[model samples]
Target: MVGRAEFVSRFGGVFEHSPFIAERAFDAGDVREPMTAGTVHAALTKHFRAASQDERLGVLRAHPDLAGKLAIAGGLTEDSRKEQAGAGLDRLSPNEHARFTELNAAYVEKNGFPFIIAVKGLTKDDILRSFETRINHNVQDEFATATEQVEKIALLRLTAILPES
Candidate 1:
């Protein structure tokens, strides 16, 4: 089994900027050997779910807005950059970019957090459609949806870095 330092170093950003989830999981002795993506994701999700609402919201807030200024400025994390580029977000036309920007603003304004999607196999249009649909959800429902999306993103990231169970 990996020690806490190595474990945290490897998986700290699984929950976006929240290394505390990994630290809390390791400190709780939740992580075990045979750390496949499924096992590690379970451990991390446990701690993430256990975190206070503010902490969870912080995790959500830590995520970069889709096709927003940070992405345009090239300020996303490596995983995020690759994921967005894979979705063709990096190559959006100006009109598509504007739509994304407008939708991102409205989503954040209503939900108090950015739209969160797994975006692994999704196209730009797929994302835009999702954004438009999800924006109409009430804040409470949207928060739950965003939280679930964050977990999905974390799992996808883990799958790339670790073996599946």
Candidate 2:
């Protein structure tokens, strides 16, 4: 069994700065051994599912828009910076960057939150295309889509951080 601090350290950033998810997981039961990527991901997703609509919105909002201001300001987390870079966000041409900026604004204006996508293994072109398509969804559907994207991000992060068995 692990202590609360250690549990948080391991699982906190799985949800992109959302330590409360880890805390909730630890409180939901004793922190058992052999917490694999799947187990930790399920723990985190349980809390995400239990969150109120407003809380889910906050979690979705915690994410930086792809190639958006946070990346420009260097305010994204180390993991986020690397993930974004991996998605070709860090090497954007001027025109692509402008297109992203425009899409970000339009998406947020329509959805009331940043567009959430798990950028790992995704090309910028894929993300841009998804943005165009996902923006067409109604607000309620968009909310569901954003929440699902957050869960996907958490699973990928968990897979990276969980100790190899």
Candidate 3:
């Protein structure tokens, strides 16, 4: 296995802009396990739980909105671009794109942070439904829910990177 520095570099941005998640996982993982995505995901979960509210919010904010402005501007990170495309977000019909933009605006206006979801295997319809549902939650509950989605997204990204061992 590679040393800690390489491990961190490879996995750091797995959680959007949060390199600290990978660093903490590297520090916490079993010396016996092969540092597979699952193990790092477990370790990262622990660190995420221990993080302050602001730190959690920061990582959530780091994620781009699904098929939102960044995608239009072609500014998303390659990983995000691909993940969104996996669910047909990239080729959205014009009406669907407009709906997403309207919902995204409403969600962010309500929650200060962008809506967060692990849009791996879901359709644009599923994402829109989730956005409609989550937008109604009170701030505290939505904050907790958004962080949970961040953890799930991190695990999914890690899984994408590591081959099964």
Candidate 4:
């Protein structure tokens, strides 16, 4: 197995761009000491400290677009992509695909960013449903939601990096 240091070194960049996430991930420790849920939670709590409303909103802005080409390539993990594609836009009935495309475009336009949700366990239909629901949120509500989603993503990453106990 890869040591903790190498694991952190390799994937730390994933969190570093976001101060809240980076600090949380870093606090989990080096290669020798694997991340724990406590560490992740502590980091998140610290980052959230005294954050202004706008600063909190900025966290949402920091997320990479979900369907944007660069986001697909840089932000998403290989497994996530496979899961998303397996749901297969291509397999969607022509009308469904067209609706998805339209929804995606409108969502991006409204949010000024790509729709993001932790898709680890969710099916394509679930994701589409989440998109529809979240797309209706006002900027402030969505900002809060995005941060919560980021926390979920961080937790997922933490599990991936830590050794199985």
Q: Candidate 1: where are CA atoms >4 Å away?
A: none
lDDT of 2 by residue, 16-87 (tens): 778888898899883567888887777779988997888888888888888989999999988889999999
What's the TM-score of each model vs. the native?
0.99, 0.95, 0.91, 0.64
lDDT of each: 0.95, 0.87, 0.83, 0.57
Give lDDT tens digits, candidate 3, residues 1-165: 667798778878888988897787677653225767787777778887788888888888898988999999999988899989998899999999988888888888888888888899898889889988888899888888988888888888878887545
Clashing pairs in 1: none
Q: Could you tell me the lDDT of residue 115 within candidate 4?
A: 69
In model 3, which runs have C-alpha deviations exceeding 4 angstroms?
28-32, 163-165
The true-versus-predicted C-alpha distance at residue 49 of model 2, in Å, is 0.5
Q: Which window of 10 residues has the lowest lDDT sum in candidate 4?
A: 24-33
Number of the top-ranking candidate, with TM-score as the measure: 1
In candidate 2, which residue ranges exceed 4 Å CA deviation? 163-165
Residue 20 displacement (Å), model 3: 1.5
Task: Please give the lDDT score for candidate 2.
Answer: 0.87
lDDT of 1 by residue, 62-141 (tens): 99999889998999999999999999999999999999999999899888899999999999999999998999999999
lDDT of candidate 2 at residue 117, scale 0 to 100: 90
Query: What's the CA error at residue 140 for candidate 3, in Å?
Result: 1.5
Model 1 residue 78 lDDT score: 95
Candidates 1 and 3, the one with greater lDDT: 1
Worst 10 residues of 3 by lDDT: 28-37
